[model samples]
Target: MINKLSIVKLNPIIIREDRKNYIVEDRKNGEFYEMPNPAVDAINLINKGKPLGDIEQILKVKYPNEDIDIIDFANQLLDLELISEVNGELILKEVDQFGPTGFLWIPESVSRFFFNKYSYIFYISLLLFNIYILLTNHHLLPNYKDYFIFSWMSLNILLWLGIGGALLILHEFGHIIAMRANGLPTRLSIGHRLFFIALETDMAAAWKLPSGKRNVLYLGGLCFDMVAFACALSIQYFYPTGPALLLAIMKILVIDIFIRFIFQCGVYMKTDLYFVIENISGSYNLMENAHHYIKSKFKKEARKAGEAVYEEEKRTIKSYSVIYFIGVLLTILVFVFYSIPQIITTMSHSIDRLSSPLFSKPFFDGAIVLVQTLTGLSLLLYSWYKKYRLKKE
Candidate 1:
């Protein structure tokens, strides 16, 4: 016997009869709900106006899994008078793309592939080999002309730079591995950052994880670089002059390692150090909010007017912000101070070369410099524009 009244109360679409089970449909979401067979039989008996105790006995004999107190199920059925009860229900829904309103989501696939596995071994080996080459021949490594003759020149620079680029890719892989180890998702991509180079790993999900986990992921790449640097230093000190080329290579290797450390400190680019600072300050959305603030200033309008910004969303107005700002500023200041002097000196020499009759063909050199400068400037401007646009939205 089924309770037509209870079925009707649960939902208008639920129909009861002397059939196998009761079928309930959710009209709002266009979804279907199937009640447990025992429950359905009980409803069927009730619809036939049978005693509740008799229906319960029949249900008990047929479905052992439904042995729990009938009162619980009855209460749930009563509550569902406003709607239908569903278990493992299916409904078509739109995917959420905005990513939890304020937070970012790092895709799980990348984290699984890059971080949770030993895929980074390839990159580590490559870096180790390069370090070996540099330690073995420091002098010949930096002077690009030593290995290049006309035909070889075309391919050699690409090959060498390709190796360097590969190490950078591996560096990002280190971050990914760290993130995955700490139960965070991450994705790696190669792009340009101003006049410099860039390899980015999206560890946005790390914000949801604990601070220690976040720090491990953030510092993993630098840790790898530091280890390589230490090995190179050890070789230099122990072996002294292994070979002329090896020594030269080591010098160049050390220079590159040092430069990478410098680049890692580039907070304006939202590098590892930037994220670490954000994590330390308990402001997961600091960078995003700062960027938003900067964009709003440019637009002369309040982008998120009347909306209360979380402490995590506040920019470097407080102590943490000021500290990170100053650290990044000082890093940039030192880089500029060292680089500008060298660049000026290089330009003066290039100009002198342009004036000399013997080296009058300055077109190639000028083109190279122009291309490098333009490429760098374009990347910087584009990155800034992207940040501004993202914050504005």
Candidate 2:
């Protein structure tokens, strides 16, 4: 039995279902939103206060050919704040703003054609290329020192590094593929942390899709990285003598992949993980708005010198204290503990290399080290600037 009061508490989307298409009307604005068949049905069922299980059963009965996971579908709806649960009763919630609708511009035809046609082949080619490199360079494994020395002076090092960077772009594309597969539009762009890295795909649209789709998008990048790692591992297994050289390359690849996953996928900083947390918290823009609200408090205090403003500030402060504390703690852990140690160790190693006699070709080695250091420093400065801007905003 449905709770009528809870159902009444929700603002429902008025959906007109036709054989060909489904149209959703925004009750407040009197604007109609058009969507394909399945999404229309899902939205209607949710609005009717149908339990997720019952809705899935209905969808399965009507569209027997379509494979839909009810739980995942339900979670997606929940994440978008289109539905809510009140005392175990499912209810619909009307969203005032739909966030950015840029995802709507991506055509389904383009998504289907590009992803379905190219993803598998792209992944396979990448794996094979890495394997080929390992095999060809097997003899050069024992002379890793020589290769490193040559790499310092060789223009080919830039070419090989470019190839490595391109592979990372493909890795981001894998994420876009999975997101598109789930009927979500994604924005792909180049993002720099401290160094100009490969590319990044914004799967923020995935949050509006079903939970299963979000999982695919989140895990897809890691899956591609794992595939590349597996191929590298296979090369190492077949050619054991060049283990050290292979291992070093593998370490760089794995670390880069893992760091991106942690920072971009981890939820604490409003990346993919943040979306997941929003889903779990039943607060769509909790972190985003919470940060804004906290900033507003400070602004209010600065602008209005009144006890009322101070009291309001205290209330907003109290509302987000726990979350803010956790964020600060995590920042300390990552920066002071993890990143600081890595930066110190890298600096120490670079200084030691600069002074070491191993750099017989002083000019070449010094230049290589200098270039690497400068690039690293530039990236660090850029990241700090970006963070500062984000905080200011």
Model 2: lDDT to the true structure: 0.54
Instruction: Write the residue-wise lDDT of candidate 1 on 191-276 in tens digits.
Output: 55545557677665554444555676787787567556656666766788688656545554565565666666666667788778
lDDT of 1 at 356: 48
Question: How would you encode candidate 2's per-residue C-alpha lDDT over 1-393 as one tens digit per residue?
Answer: 332222212235666543235545544333334456777777667667766667777888899998867666555545545454544665655556443234555566665654553665765576676556556755422221222323343232453355467667767766765666667656765445434444567765554444433555665665577576655455555666665756556544543443454455334455555555444443444665565555665787543543433443444344444655565565555555445665565445455556757636644555575686577567667666766887896
> How many residue pairs collide in each prediction?
30, 3
TM-score of each: 0.49, 0.46
**For all the candidates, what are their Cα RMSDs to the real structure?**
15.5, 14.6
Q: Measured by TM-score, how close is model 2 to the native structure?
A: 0.46
lDDT of each: 0.54, 0.54
Lowest lDDT block of 10, candidate 1? 95-104
Once fitted onto the true fold, the runs of candidate 2 whose alpha carbons sit more than 4 angstroms away are 1-167, 183-185, 192-198, 204-208, 232-243, 264-266, 289-342, 349-360, 376-393
lDDT of 2 at 74: 50
Model 1 earns a TM-score of 0.49
Residue 315 local lDDT, model 2: 47
